[model samples]
Target: MVTVAVTAVAAALVMTGCSGGPSSPATDNVAGTPSSGASSTSKSTPTPTPAVVDVTPADGATGVKPTAPVVVKVSSGSLSEVSVKDAQGKAVEGKLANGTWTSKARLAPSTAYTVSVTAAGSDGTPATTTSRFTTLKPAVTATYGILYAGQTVGVGMPASIQFDSAVTTPELRAQVEKLVTVTTSPKTEGHWGWLDNRQLMWRPKDYWQPGTKVTVNAPLTGVQTGDGKWIANDDSASFTVGSSMISTVDIKNHVMTVTRGGQVLRTIPISAGRPGPETETRSGTKVIIRKEGTVIMDSSTIGIKKGEPGYYKIKTQSAMRVTWTGEYLHSAPWSVGSQGSSNVSHGCVNMAPENAAWMYANSKAGDVVKFTGSSRVFQPSEGIGVWQYSYANWVKQSALA
Candidate 1:
């Protein structure tokens, strides 16, 4: 009995030894048995690596103007995600190109912006980075103004203002018009006429009151015109109108009377056309073309041959103003004795220099310069002075209403 007991104990010890300690499980049944949970747990599982991403326009950059384009780039695996935000953190609209993103429109000035991006690695791990930037401050400046002021009656004297820069906004027009103030003797009501985007004209529906005072104030110190340009600084000018100085020239009588406020200033002796080469001056209103201290009268320039019987040439002196083609109210010293007495000039209203000066001093741009006593009324042509047309007819010539 003692020997059998000992044998059983030895067998038990051997079985325990054959079971491969803790490392082996069901080793004897490896040919067909499934592995226990302990066996499967022995094999380790791998954890995926995280991905890294980078975005452009890094954090805290400033002095950025809206005119500049916003660009963003990503790194690491790829641009798996990207976004831009305003100061309020609202997502701004943008477009993605390749691994980069961009905004089509400019950003607002003096604003803060943020950019975020995410990139994933092959291991399915995502990394993100954010950047901040600020926009540039706004610029404030002023601009200059142009003035066209004169008082030639008959539509020739229009108050024109031309802006050096193009006005992109209509509001600018109103701002400019506010600077204009007209003080006419006969109180007139008128509005601005925009000739184009850059030019404006101010005129009454009719001619200005005979003796009106027109003033222009252009305070375009820092206004923005357009195309990144501002009005010029230190620009201003003014002009004045004299009393009502209206003149009437009768071609048949060959006389011109200067009047002021219904009072005749002078009755200058004059000579009118003999009517062969359309010497008749238009009978409508007229404006002075220009003033010259002296001018040389050449008949050839007016389609008159130098040696033609009707053509004559002479040097004129004290020529105050010439208002028509081949016509001048100049000092005819040679004919001074005959002036105011007989029609002896070649169609010019010959007058003393003093008389011409008086006319010049009293006349403003819009003052009526009327001519009568012509069989054929004055018709407007390109060569004729601007005043040769009726007020209604002159308005029709303007592109603007």
Candidate 2:
């Protein structure tokens, strides 16, 4: 406080003697004298209230994730204002709830962002703070897309994607998966499940209905995967489902019957696995994944040594792969006599050249090739063999479910 006091005093004016020595004599200092028209006043200054503001992905942060949110909190008062923007002054969308503020928009890669916050304390005292940060720069970039030969897949077919680089972490994989959108024309529902870090596949709860249309969108240019891998560009694909064409092979009878829409189309002579375990074909519903004019058959690929009795490698024609365990339906001129007469093949379906060519030409990816009369069961991971598992069991493999 400051105080000012003045005294009021009435004094008479006295004329000094006309002495030449002193024209004006000095007057004594006023002591305990009152001054007229004097007043006193006092004033005090008020103290201010304390304010608080906290921000995360702290101020001056560098190499932050693009998906990282800008979070701000205020104490002793609710949030009054917040602004987040990029280097070009483009605003970053966000929302304020209670005393906290969060960024709604995903940040950009290799870009700088500035955030400012304002609030007030209990006594209306203003508070303000700011932060600047930069998102991590990508070192390598790649693209990815789904694969369905001829743009027509079977009901049992899974939507598969192959990435140029591996995405190992769950969080980073999820961020990349979010950029992928799948929509079906018939409105069927499905979910994506990661077979490995790099391979992703989606399938409906049950087999896709015949004639279903599928659309895939991967707007992934700025989407980041683990290990500094970012999407270089966007990708999209649309494919359709074909009629229900399925085939069943009975190893005991040495025959395979092809069917479509619950009607038998043809019954062809075929030779399945021999009785012994060393040459027994797995019995289960398997999807025909590929049909090439010629495929190099190798015994070592399935753990059979070169000197082993059943070991042999041959470039076979009209090859149609049914499983990853070296199982195929192809021409076997050498086994022509044994085909349909006896099961003499080493875990593969053997037929005459004309019959094999006819089957291969008509079959496409996702066509079912079920085998019976075998003791061994087909592994679900074997080439597109998604039908081996029951519908209830298949949904359990999905990551999103």
Candidate 1 lDDT by residue in tens digits, 70-151: 6765443455766777867766667888866777644655578877766665454556667788865545333335453443
In terms of TM-score, which candidate is strongest?
Answer: 2
Off by over 4 Å in 2: 1-61, 70-134, 137-144, 162-181, 189-199, 218-235, 276-278, 305-308
TM-score of each: 0.46, 0.67
List lDDT for all candidates, in order: 0.57, 0.76
Best by lDDT: 2
Model 2 lDDT per residue over 1-401, tens place? 11112223334444443333532233323567543333545444344444567777787889887768889887655567989988789887788887789988677777888888777766665666677888777787656767873388777787777687787677777777666888888998777766566767777777788999888777665577766766645677888888888999998889999988879988888888888876888989888877777988888887887998778889899998887678889999888888877998888899899888888877878887788988988877766756666666666655444
| Candidate 1, poorest ten consecutive residues by summed lDDT | 1-10
How close to the true structure is residue 343 of candidate 2, measured as C-alpha lDDT? 90
* Model 1 backbone overlap count: 26
Q: Among all windows of ten consecutive residues in candidate 2, which has the lowest summed lDDT?
A: 1-10
